[model samples]
Target chain A: MILLAPWELLLLMFANFFSRATCMTVGPRSSMGFETCYCLSWRVAVEANNAQAWRTVPAQCVLYVENYMLGGQYNKDLDVVIEQISTYLNGIVAAGDGKDAWVLDIDDTCLSNLLYYQGKRFGGDPWDPSAFKSWAQRGLCPPIPAVLRLYSRLVQGGFKVFLLTGRDEEALGVSTAENLHAWGFVGYERLILRGPAYRGQSAVGFKSSMRKQLVEEGYRIRGNVGDQWSDLQGDFIGDRIFKIPNPMYFVP
Target chain B: MILLAPWELLLLMFANFFSRATCMTVGPRSSMGFETCYCLSWRVAVEANNAQAWRTVPAQCVLYVENYMLGGQYNKDLDVVIEQISTYLNGIVAAGDGKDAWVLDIDDTCLSNLLYYQGKRFGGDPWDPSAFKSWAQRGLCPPIPAVLRLYSRLVQGGFKVFLLTGRDEEALGVSTAENLHAWGFVGYERLILRGPAYRGQSAVGFKSSMRKQLVEEGYRIRGNVGDQWSDLQGDFIGDRIFKIPNPMYFVP
Candidate 1:
């Protein structure tokens, strides 16, 4: 290698530092010069249910996850899911017996808690139950527009829509229902929330038990939609299960 | 708008064309001035099992899929899954009765067909059964390195490893075994391929039936890993199910 002058060496060092800084800020690089976005991989794992029981977004990925949540990509992703749901809905022959039913998880599926999550580091911080409960009491969660459209279609098509959630019934039931109504989630047959019966139960256990109760009630559960795997898993998990994206937190 | 000279107008038009071209090549933008990578959304949807019965990668996403598969992210993603699996394995108290089993899917999980897929536009082309069969008959597929490592650990840790695949047994039994053996997967307890009894069955049906049979044989499936959701769905899905990424193709 040719030797560089002092000034030339200083300039080269500065250039290297600038490139390294850019990589750290924009995208991370592996030692082999391969750019690897671990945050994207983590988010994909979470979506696929491969990564289970995760409590928080990785610290390093907080900004990345925040951007992904607020970015146009999240809405576009929701649109794709909605398109698929609409296509599936089009092919259904509604029995018109008023027993044909659809199941939807409320939080992050019907009503988004993005406003509360915005202050929670987009799930980078540990879960705060009381803080979240207070936020729920305020009843400010917005409707995920695509899901609302799907809900309206389901309602008009004569399919019974059931909103199932893990929210505490005693504390936030009234506010939750009002928020859902304000956001146009009306016409749903039932809004089921976690009651004393489901206290200390896992999301999978509670939701699956509730779904079993629905099936026992003679409701033919046609489709299930949720942001968490727990909401879509276990016995009586309808004929078709649709998992929406939720990189923020895992229910179990 | 201000009036412009002919040369100035030409320069402005050129700039606009350049920016538009850059956007097209780098990312497709929505009309709302938001850059959206539909391809990334599609991949995420696929991983989440939200987009089901997909035949191939989206035409526009072929390059993106190719790069993701060949680039470092794929391996990084695998590492994340393996990390989770390893952690789960660490917590298990093996019975030491030789009935504790771990199941893994073959294609894309154990033996990768990446070399063959490289010629098929990385699954952008429609699947050709005869061509795929010829490639499998050749037995040149390589082991996914990370999975092989996991396999070795499982074997050494007293877990009976089972290799399950949808390949036809009559045509590919010997070659598939040899391929797996050559790839350092020699310690697997059994290599189960699709036989005549399972012909024309869906992946979910065949795999679940086989798993049920395994359970009947007094095997306790502690963990199951596969690149397809079909491998993880249905009855007897074991205590833990791990889904490895396979954006290149969907089995069902």
Candidate 2:
């Protein structure tokens, strides 16, 4: 690529900065695909140790995530993380106690609810509990390929994988389990759903607390892979915390 | 920070590229504390998701590793991976199967031997069999804190921690056992070092063969943690693999 002239580069930089500084697409086209500062300067930020540069994540990162998810970038990016995990697994010689746990989060982590998110246009709607519940009851969400492969390989490689999601246990338990099973997330140790008691709690607090319980119970969580940072947040998080991309919606 | 003009940004980029392109420090102090493209770009690379940018690793990354080893960065970096492991373990509800295994490598993985590496300035000297063998015989190599903690925790977590290294089992078996026990790596399942049969085999071939044997015997490799890539290499690897930094030497 030809180097940009000083003036031309400045113009491009200003345009990039302008777009991120505004919620320009928190409207009709938000989920259709939008660009962000991350998509602009990620290369420079990635190769440099400049912390300041990496902090350039777009304010409307969900838009970028939408595009990345629908575009080829998502698969390429996921492939890299998968390879890294495989490399990590290759070195592992499991404890074989059958207590080795690979904790997976449900939502965007295991099953990509792109359909819902796309329709919502990146949180364009609010508190439609009924509609969301109806979506879950469909029991038809597809499994994420990368996570599915990781889950299956890990089981063969010595881990007993489990799903620990924040879904309301009483309401979503049956469908969640059914959806997962039907979607090829066949054999897991358990599907731990949040109960009514967790109604108003924060994900971090809830997950951290629940994971603490797992530790106290004698389980050894070897790997926790999730899309949201919230999925990975909290106490007793596991041996490794791998955060998959999710700029769509902030749990907090 | 004020935004850089196009020219200024290009200048900085050029400088970084120049530093990495030359054998600038492949000299008297290459292993002392020289910087590499990694050190230069680690900050930005740390947080960004640009796989291509992050893939620009230095060819002589070992030199960069030397500084990181002596510097506080090594511990800090390792702490992250370790804490992640702890979190996983916390969520683990173990199977209590008598066959769970946590495979560990000797030499650089479990034992530090930093004194020699530092003296040699990160593989500065050529092969010194007598010196290395003598050092091993000293039975005084220190245990690495990060790995030591993982070992201890896995044991308490009901894992049958085992020593699987490239060291000669027949020659170093007694001393290896003695050294590990002496250094507080107590109560391992078994110390499987290379025997006469492994004399002419490569580390990858030998280790892979042994791990495969373990699998065929129905032993589950839950986790394998090591410093060298070779330690983590081969078939029948495990459930999860962790890599500790070691830029001093390349096993392959």
Candidate 3:
């Protein structure tokens, strides 16, 4: 071994730490720092719907969740899911009878609340209904580009797209529609918000009842897409359901 | 600035590179190399049940998948899921009724096929039924420790546990039961396997029919756990569904 200057020794130590932290290792655990490895597992658990009814993001994972939401991984994950949906759409031989329909969840599926979530520490803080309502009332949430593109494709493919959300219809009906329209979420057959009939129902119950009604109305739900598991579960869930990753929160 | 020795310059260069490669940044993309990020996104999509009917793991992601399956992250992820299940089980009032039942899937859920998968490139290669059957006939797959523990807790807590699998009864019945027994999987109410009437049925169909029969027979399915979504979907899926991580293969 050769002698090194003090600065050189510090640099060498830094390199070693970095290498140990970044490189993936084949063993009982990854070489990533414990925080990173644990947070990644937590996020995967959330996306897989194994960790249910989590009220808020773990405090330690706020930054991790923030980076993931704004980082390219979130967009890339969306791309993969959209690719599958596109492939499925291409394979469908649509019935000329006009009964083919598709369901899409509004928040975080068609429109992203990233701007609102940013202020809430990416869901590190408890949910504030009034705060979220004010944010939604502004009609400023941006369209999730990939989901917007898919919506366009579905409309063009002659599939009747229904925009469904758990937002109270009496309070948010106008603003939500305007926000959606501003983002070119055009041509959807219906925008079904939570009307008085679904006042006390859970998200799963509300969405399931809506889908059941759509089925009874003679529509064949070819596919359903949502950022929450509640949107894809329950009766009449359709032929194929695509789950978009949303670790920031769980609906039920 | 002070001039440095040649070795110091080399060390500084390495430190810079490592820092750039390892540090998590708040930006459009993570600082991780493109391969690692893309493979991670792919895995997430698969786990979220968005990437459907994938024939084999992406060739480039074979090593990534191997690391994830063998690495400590897999065990930690299992721990998170098991913790949730335990919390739920502890909260049950139990009604003191013997009808309280839990359903669990076998391959890759209760028993891990990692040994065979190691030789198969961690699902880099296409599935081979004959080869897998041969491996199963050996009755050598080890128990997933976390699941084995959960099974014991469920049994001791007065919940009837059902061991369900898509494995064929005629070919794998004896070996599978022996392997489970050899690994301390005792006191299960029944070991369900694919029999003659379910020969060509898909996993969702066969498992759904069985659960429906269980319901008709007055078994209250309190919880269902499986590595595959097919095991958790369809009619009569239990009150709670726990999806265990299995990135190695897709059943349907």
Top-scoring candidate (TM-score): 3
TM-score of each: 0.88, 0.44, 0.90
Model 3 complex DockQ against the native: 0.40
Docking class of 2: incorrect
Best of the two (2, 3) by TM-score: 3
After superposition, candidate 1 runs with Cα above 4 Å error: A1-36, B1-36
* Candidate 1 per-residue C-alpha lDDT over B1-252 given as tens digits, one digit per residue, 9 for 90 to 100: 234456754554444333221223225443312222566678778888888888887777887677778755677788888988988887896696999999999999998889999999998998999999999999989999999999999999999998989999999999999898887898889999999999999999999999998999999999999999999988899999999998889988
Worst 10 residues of 1 chain B by lDDT: B17-26
Among all windows of 10 consecutive residues in model 2 chain A, the one with the lowest summed lDDT is A45-54
lDDT of 2 by residue, B29-107 (tens): 2331234333423322223221211222344554554655664445544554565456556766447677888788888
Query: Candidate 1: interface RMSD in Å?
Result: 12.4
Q: Native-contact fraction for each model?
A: 0.37, 0.02, 0.41
Give a tens-digit lDDT track for model 3, residues B130-181: 9999999999999999999999999898889999899999999999999999
lDDT of 2 by residue, A1-252 (tens): 346567866655544333321223223323211233233233222121111112223445545545545643444445556665676677676685787778888997789887876776644344366888888888778888888888889877878787888888888899998888886887777788898888889887888877887778778988787766567655788876665655445564
**For model 3, which pairs clash?**
A28-B72, A29-B72
The stretch of ten residues in a row with the least summed lDDT in candidate 2 chain B is B44-53
Q: What local lDDT score does residue A122 receive in model 3, on the 0 to 100 scale?
A: 95
Q: In DockQ terms, which candidate is top?
A: 3
